[model samples]
Target: SQQGEEDPQALSIQEGENATMNCSYKTSINNLQWYRQNSGRGLVHLILIRSNEREKHSGRLRVTLDTSKKSSSLLITASRAADTASYFCATDDIYNQGGKLIFGQGTELSVKP
Candidate 1:
């Protein structure tokens, strides 16, 4: 399966700081998306950038893609305790005739007050 994998498994940061995570995947994809899950909450779409794009940003969240290396990166600026949650990357092959998403193991983020 063409699934993305997040590194560091876990991360801890202070409030007002920045949090960064990395994701790598196998196979080619039409686009990649980042989602956030807050503890018991469901995953919420953070952002999505197509393969043709190099970088994208939403509010405090920034995402970058490098298709050549089959990797992507996420950066969250001005982190807060509320930012404590899990971050995951999902790969979608929109042009694969069928729309399917492959999710990663996710990185647990912890923000301190």
Candidate 2:
């Protein structure tokens, strides 16, 4: 079951601006991943962090996870209209051995040009 709950169900920002999204989840997780989807299409993997890691970055994307708080956040810098998409956080339950990921409701981001 998806236990993660994303903040700001939707967001609107202008080009060159910065967008931030947050996610909170219940229970312990082995790893957490951030994904982006455009126009209801396939998910594009953004970044992933293991329980032992505090933060990870890829391109203009930055992800931070604090296991002690059971929360994580995604930050996008210099946003563009093309960056408009829905972002979701998935978690690999530590107790679930099947490797199933539980997803959050998602944060819809709109970057206006």
Candidate 3:
């Protein structure tokens, strides 16, 4: 599985500001998804936007995909301290049409009040 890179490896923002994390991949991909992980906890599925889809939304989470650039971005609006976590972008579980996801390093967000 190939891995992508995320920008702003670590981000510290205010409670109300918006946080944006970007991920760029290397090869072709079918689907792109974003997940959140709280400290000492399992990953929580946030949103999944297909390669064909340009943007998607789930509650306060917004995701955008740019196939031409092989990049995607996760935007969290009205951030809160509880939203402080590591966000990662992953590719479809289509390892040669198998079931395996390729994930990026991640963007560590720290929301402070």
Candidate 4:
């Protein structure tokens, strides 16, 4: 069963603008991770936030997790056209064996130059 679902199915913005996406899940999770996929390519890991962590950042990417709310958000700062891609949130359910990740539907982001 799918654990996470992304919001705002799609988004578009100009270069240098920030992009924000959200994800909500159904159950307790060990960790939540964000990934980006370029057109016709595989997804790339962006960041991972543990259940105990409230927020994390790497480069221009910021991620926040609210376990109480079973939700998370990703923010990209000073976005570029190259940043255009589909973003997905994945969850590692605490009850699941083998630590499998259930991916969200994803949000398609388009950055116009």
Off by over 4 Å in 1: 94-98
Q: Best candidate per lDDT, number? A: 2
TM-score of each: 0.93, 0.95, 0.93, 0.95
Evaluate model 3: give its TM-score: 0.93
Q: What digit string (tens of lDDT, one per residue) describes model 4 on residues 1-113?
A: 67788998999999999999999999899899999999969989999999999999999999999999999999999999999999999998889734789999999999999
Worst 10 residues of 1 by lDDT: 92-101
lDDT of 2 by residue, 31-70 (tens): 9999999999999988999989998989999999999999
lDDT of 2 at 68: 95
Model 2, TM vs. native: 0.95
RMSD of each: 1.5, 1.1, 1.5, 1.1
Show where candidate 2 strays beyond 4 Å. none
Model 4 scores a C-alpha lDDT of: 0.93
lDDT of each: 0.90, 0.94, 0.89, 0.93
* Tens-digit lDDT string for candidate 1 (48-72): 9899999999999999999999999
lDDT of 4 at 56: 95
The per-residue C-alpha lDDT of model 4 at residue 51 equals: 91
